[model samples]
Target chain A: MVSNTNELSHEAFLYLIRQSGIDLDTGHDKELFDYVKSVLSSLDPLRSIDVGSTEPPMMFIPAQEDV
Target chain B: MTDVNLCYASVRALSELVSKKQVSPVEIIEAHLQRISETEPVLNSFITLLADEAQEAARRAEAMINRGNHLGPLHGIPVGLKDLFNTGGVKTTSGSRIFDNYVPIEDCTVASKFRAAGAILIGKLNMHQFAYGPTGENPDYGHMHNPWDPEKIAGGSSGGSGSAAASGQCTITMGSDTGGSVRIPSSFCGIVGLKPTYGLVSRNGLTPLSWCLDHPGPMVRTVEDAALTMNVISGFDPKDVASARVNIPDYTENLNKSIQGLRVGIVKEFFDAPLDAEVESIVRKAISHIESMGAEIHEVSMSMFEQSQAISGTILMCEAAAYHRELLKDHAEELYAPVRLRLESGLLITAADYLKAQQARALFNTSVNALYQTVDVLVGPSQPITAPTLLAQSVEINGTRVGTTAAVTQYSRPYNITGTPAITVPCGFSASGMPVGLQIAGKAFDESTVLQVAHAYESTTDWHLKHPDIAS
Candidate 1:
């Protein structure tokens, strides 16, 4: 497991892609890896925030009758 | 009235003409169909045109009006859908090759509501593939061109809705906003686009891009038309879980209301960020114009505004990826390059990362809601720049180069993250003849105030009436 998100290596990134049930053997593999790296970098700062006990963001709720 | 004049008239005007028997619904539909035939070649706004059905519906509307049965404000008006909305027995492609042949068996909630109100469904407009990107460039469906300048882009994934409405191809259109999809196009195309509070409008039959962030709303030629459209399409639908159970108010009731004593907050961070010189000047002039109208203006700040992009980007990727996981595995090759890349990138996000972004979103919403307590509405630039050329991937803003996708949606996406009602109206034009937008947003479920402020500003300026000279 990679502890530091910003420091994720290309090898570890490819390993995670395969683990997610995606085969990265196509011609677009290099491009896909670069995009994954960009996304992970963008998400690095979010990992450090303290969310506390707030509920996860959910846009929809069951009607009152169902509740 | 000439066909060109009828094509550009407001829904309010057209409905009155239909009710008074001065203009038959058949004539209105015929005029629009003729306009579409003339403009479609240059705009590339529509994926499919329903000429035969539109004429048939117009005749029915005419016969009903002839019998003294007036449906209401939207009666006999021709409107367009964003192509992602399911229309019974009509092909809904969603601007992707993956679903090119998929036909829905029933109309979505919004579509059914329009039909119920007597609005004619003219056609389905083009969009970014699966509503993934903001540029409105689709490799599968031909790219939608900006009505203002054919060489520039019409902001997307609701790109076609913007171009069609601006060019008078339709009276009003519907578009979905995940991260500024609706507002971006409206800003770029010089029209009115409103994204109502999260649960204000039901998303039952629309194709899902990001479950939590997706908001289906109105894009029209005037703020009043947007308000009128909202009156017909908004309310609680038991089928849509996100549908708000609160009472739906008349969106147009306060259009003529005075904003004399209203408090308007000009967000300091929005102007402080890097922006095009022309856009910044026009937005400032709009603010000064509103101040001159007797409304009180004050500078306010929200620090969390800076984190909105990352938070919105994360949630959008994860949710969209979850929805398209199976499709990605089976049909990855058929997807557009940028869209497929975005979907696959979601695979790299861990569950922890997704939850962290949601947590950040909750904080951002709290901060924004608290700020509303200090002011009635917030005003800023809808987009930081005008439309860019079709071939350019990035633009120079304030002497620094930035990606087009990031700059186009910078100001509008924050509202989606907070689930507030925000509207974009044409404020002024740039030196180069492109349009600039002024965004006014109010507290959650308070679309009335947003529309009221926008309409007030629009009444003072002739920006909305200016149409692109497409023939040139």
Candidate 2:
């Protein structure tokens, strides 16, 4: 599923780039289109590992020195 | 003098000349202002230049020195601040139209530090919309171009800081790195950017991207210069609880420290990836240079690097949504398309998913601490590729096309998750003449070691001395 999902496919990944709002003429640049797709697939936050409910979400706290 | 005056004459050099009465602050500020004007049209690095105020401040510094009054290490120095930082009574647009006219009643801690050190604020540098993007392409505020090649990008969310520092607009510029914003642009623009260990600098009055991942640090042409600037801004802040209570070391104190037999580990998983040949070559050279300097190199692996990126992204998106939830709903149509899409998509992430990411964070941080026991530093290519053309929305590296965002940021985000420090310095340029950066990452709260290694690389190479000759 990880390898075959359109979310993982080159084309759907390209769509993610388009959705991200970078200005590009998708018609002319096949390389960019494919590349954007590849990059997006890699960025899927859902794929890498299993998360548990007990852990606190990582974040930058403006005032939390110990965080 | 023409070339030397352009840049690489340290803040110390400029301040000393001013101190000796050999050069007036007014003259230094005017020179930088003229250079900014000369380069802005081509590089678009500075969104705003406070020519009037800078000149006025310079005049005062000159008057003070004449009366035998000295402020500090930054006296009479010219530097730039990212527009995202709050400046009392000045519009801090954050490169977004939403805050176009927004002004604050107080200056950000970092900005005030610069002001108090007798540093003259040249003006505000542009950034990615709300410091969200890595490529620094601001749909609202026009993109800041690379000084070396206008068609190529200056890396962002600290794009302006990177471009301005590289283009000689300032001796140093303040930038915030949330997932490599500071270091990424510094790498692409061919300068040194220090992403201090989280909490080393105060976040008060600095705009938030993700509540936990944002780090404010200095970008300069050299590691020594970064150390010089960092010494002033880093330390405990009552306004920022995240500011560490630990003593802020004299950053320059370790500049010439020997790394003889220091354990430097190269993350094979990271460098072994499909990185651009040019980037890999320069990175290998940097590692070799470090090894030659009496450091031992070992191959280290952590499967959690990818995991860290995801967890960091999840936390970033979820936390970002928390900040923008209301604003995004009301101003959905107003957001620059990419930022809106990112913030909006973040809403789809379930609470379970966010918690999962967080739990994984504790596991990953523990694993990283284990890796640190085996090595004092981890090094890698800052970007998978050099600066892509401004026209390129994505680039191909190692034969795989990757989107601009992921390719630029993948290597830099993990350190953010582990709350460790990372710095990027120009290693070399590609064949097409674009620069590549080597990132030196150290153990938690071990910024002193990272700075030492970076400063040593800088001492051995002239890459830091090179700048864009914008005009023929």
Q: Candidate 1: lDDT of A12?
A: 87
CA deviation > 4 Å runs, candidate 2:
A1-54, A57-67, B1-6
How would you encode candidate 1's per-residue C-alpha lDDT over B221-241 as one tens digit per residue? 899999999999999998797
lDDT (10s digit) by residue, model 2, range B162-241: 98999888988999988899998899999999999888888999889887889998998888788888889988898986
TM-score for chain B considered on its own, for each of the candidates: 0.99, 0.97
CAPRI classification of candidate 2: incorrect
Summarize candidate 1's per-residue lDDT along A1-67 as a digit string, tens digits. Answer: 5435666787887788778777666678888877777777777667666778877776565757998
- Candidate maximizing DockQ: 1
Task: TM-score each candidate.
Answer: 0.97, 0.89
**Best by lDDT, which number?**
1
RMSDs, each prediction?
1.7, 5.3
| Candidate 1 local Cα displacement, residue A27, angstroms | 2.7
Chain A TM-scores, all candidates?
A: 0.58, 0.38
Would you list the C-alpha lDDT of every candidate in the order shown?
Answer: 0.89, 0.81
lDDT of 2 at B77: 88
